[model samples]
Target: MKVNIRKWNGVAIWSWDVPKEEVCGICRASFDTTCSSCKFPGDQCPLVLGVCTHRFHTHCIEKWLEVETSKNLCPMCRQWFQEKTDDGDGGTGAHANTNVHSSDVVSTT
Candidate 1:
């Protein structure tokens, strides 16, 4: 599956859709923990990517953020970051971006 990464002139700038696989990032809970939540298999878990690009579930990343305050990096990458603030009241767990840059895209993989 692919969609045009459009340009200003309505031209397709880029096109990509990598096949998602069973990322071992998510902790194999006893059962499906992604219940009452939103996620898929291929799209990386934003949390794991925080430490590294190796994908995992959002919940998994949140847990890491809560536990490891000094470990500000993707579990796979060891990159440090300037953590952002919660965009809004994101429930018990706040939300923030990893500040990852476009140049860092390749390293995450």
Candidate 2:
């Protein structure tokens, strides 16, 4: 009898409270995984969504927003990315409830 085992270990898995399959529109990277430019996911490279219901890696969107051609619009939907308030209470006005997924509603953290 011969027994062979390559490797065995517990791997952590993470999921986002998104209706569609969790994937960053900008980098197309899974929400549980880091973008190509990032070495790791989570706080280091968190996921952020725009008012248009489009999602992307925080770093990825931040960089994209810096581009002169972006005009503060979402890449997928071209909707204005409503800026959040200073206290993170989201923005005021029409897009205040733009957030599709609420942490209080469905969060693993």
Candidate 3:
């Protein structure tokens, strides 16, 4: 049997490697979804994993850190929030602005 095709379409789907039941510590939204401040998911609302091992939506954590009372602490563990770096050095500091993205994250899955 022989087959010939002239037209073709392809669809692809992608998702964060986080567990389905896990939610952002700050926004309480799943890692696969955007935070309340974001209109859509993906880079616009990337997930940030803190040195304390708590995860939050980028916008959520950014907003929280901006508040004077937040004291740059992880909303979940109350530890100083720092963007876990690639070197596994814990991170620089809460205000370091690591600019990390989900795609750049080392998969913990």
- Which of the numbered candidates is closest to the native, going by highest TM-score? 3
The deviation in Å at residue 20 for candidate 1 is 3.3
Candidate 1 residue runs with Cα over 4 Å from true position: 1-18, 22-52, 81-109
Write one digit per residue (lDDT tens) for candidate 2, span 24-107. 888887887888888976778877755555678888899889999999888888888754433444433354644665655875
**Per-residue accuracy of model 3 over 1-109 as CA lDDT, tens digit each:** 9999999999978888788999997778888888889888887888888877777888899999999999988888888888775564445445455577888989778
Worst 10 residues of 1 by lDDT: 28-37
- lDDT of every model, 2 decimals: 0.44, 0.74, 0.82
Candidate 2 vs candidate 3, lDDT winner: 3
lDDT at residue 98 of model 2 (Cα atoms): 48
Q: Once model 1 is optimally superposed onto the true structure by TM-score, how far is the C-alpha of residue 84 displaced, in angstroms?
A: 12
Deviation of model 1 at 100, angstroms: 16
> Who is ahead in lDDT, 1 or 3?
3
Estimated TM-score for each candidate: 0.34, 0.60, 0.75
User: Which prediction has more favorable TM-score, 1 or 2?
Assistant: 2
Backbone clash count, each prediction separately: 6, 0, 0
Instruction: In model 3, state the lDDT of residue 77.
Output: 81
Please tell me which predicted candidate would have the highest lDDT against the true structure.
3
Model 3 residue 89 CA deviation in Å: 7.5
